[model samples]
Target: MPNDTILVVDDSPTEQRVVVSALQAKGYRVITAADGDEAIEKAGREQPRLIVLDVVMPKKNGYQVCRQLKSAPETQHIKVLMLTTKNQDADKFWGMKQGADAYLTKPFASDELITNVTRLY
Candidate 1:
């Protein structure tokens, strides 16, 4: 739904733009953060329903952010989808262990992104 906001966290400008554009085109209220710390701040401040998180980032990483968010009562309700280039099975397992709702690798299709986001809604 357009009413639900999504926070996209990635250090890469191009990747951030691509994801933001795709989500905006799909009618979601999209917000963005360039790294993990910013992601955590925006997630707390904006209270977005979902967060599209990147694994490798400065200040902090997706796993750290997800773990912190899940542990905090204020942010524990937010859903996190790990969107990163880390495609290893261990990466997915660790992400899920940290409370990620979904794990999608890089080079994902726009439709797949939309579908996963919609499922979260």
Candidate 2:
């Protein structure tokens, strides 16, 4: 998808930079949010094509944000990729239940992220 934007939602500055740089390098516009609340606001205001979300955050967590977004008619069309350190099978299942299109564990390669995102779009 040409001109598609991606929202990288993570509290860790390093993780945010990693995802932003990786996606930008692949010619996608990248937006950053420090936590789930910000992510929700940006998801509405920026209307990015995809959201790369982290599970652990100070307020509203990724799962809660994803659920909120999925439930909202205005944001439901946006795809969500859950990227987090929580790699348990149950976590993946819950993420899916919360409406994540894809689930990825931490330490995942940049290429893998790009590949999964590209495949999703």
Candidate 3:
């Protein structure tokens, strides 16, 4: 397996598992967070090269987490891909406005996610 660690953040257990499975299949070392709070905490502690962040979650949302992460020197260099069910253009704009490096809508194909992640990583 590759040594590149990726942090997967999502509130849904099923969704999280799917993301983890896809990333792991491609040989990435994966860590998971169930909510935004844990996402931020683990991102700082693990210092993963990339974070797959969900827009909707308990505690802080993806935008908030992304904003904070991008603003802080410790985590600002880390890249973030916002993965969510919100497919609206405005949502994508908002995510980008909050410092997300990329955005992907849910029901995403494994290859699609991998493509975006690898590009950002």
Candidate 4:
């Protein structure tokens, strides 16, 4: 499972660092994108096992990226975990509607993120 690549997508450099570092510390091969467009491109090219996506981003939001990935036959099998600062119930429901496999809010514990990523495999 550690061999599986995970794409970490966020516009915030700080959030990206935190999640990427956490995942790398767990020995997972992690890649990152600064925005949703890059996220979608990387998801298609890299064929990552999972994508850790942020809700708000430039070019495209997580919901849009998630919807596109889920809709595409080649990418639909990849697990999507919506990790964002949006903690509202409606936001979570929307993420689910977009086909997120799991939804995690910001300020999440490293262990929790690792646990969620591991569970996906």
Model 2 residue 104 CA deviation (Å) reads: 0.5
Per-residue lDDT tens digits for candidate 3, residues 9-111, read 9999999999999999998899999988899899888899999999999999999999999999999999999999999999999999999999999999999
Q: Show where candidate 1 strays beyond 4 Å.
A: 1-3
Better of 2 and 3 by lDDT: 3
Q: Estimate each model's TM-score.
A: 0.96, 0.96, 0.96, 0.96
Q: Which portions of model 4 miss their true places by more than 4 Å? A: 1-3
The sequence of per-residue lDDT tens digits that candidate 4 reaches over residues 1-121 is 2238999999999999999999999888989999989999999899999999999999999999999999998899999999999999999999999999999998899999998999985
Candidate 4 residue-wise lDDT at 64: 99
What is the Cα-based TM-score of model 2? Answer: 0.96
Which TM-score value belongs to model 1?
A: 0.96
- Report, for every candidate in turn, its global Cα lDDT versus the true structure: 0.93, 0.92, 0.93, 0.93
lDDT of 1 by residue, 25-103 (tens): 9888899999889998888888999999999999999999999999988899999999999999999999999999999
> In model 3, which residue pairs have backbone atoms overlapping below 3 Å?
none
Tens digits of lDDT, candidate 2, 1-121: 2237888999999999989988889888888999989999999988889999999999999999999999998899999999999999999999999999999999999989989999887
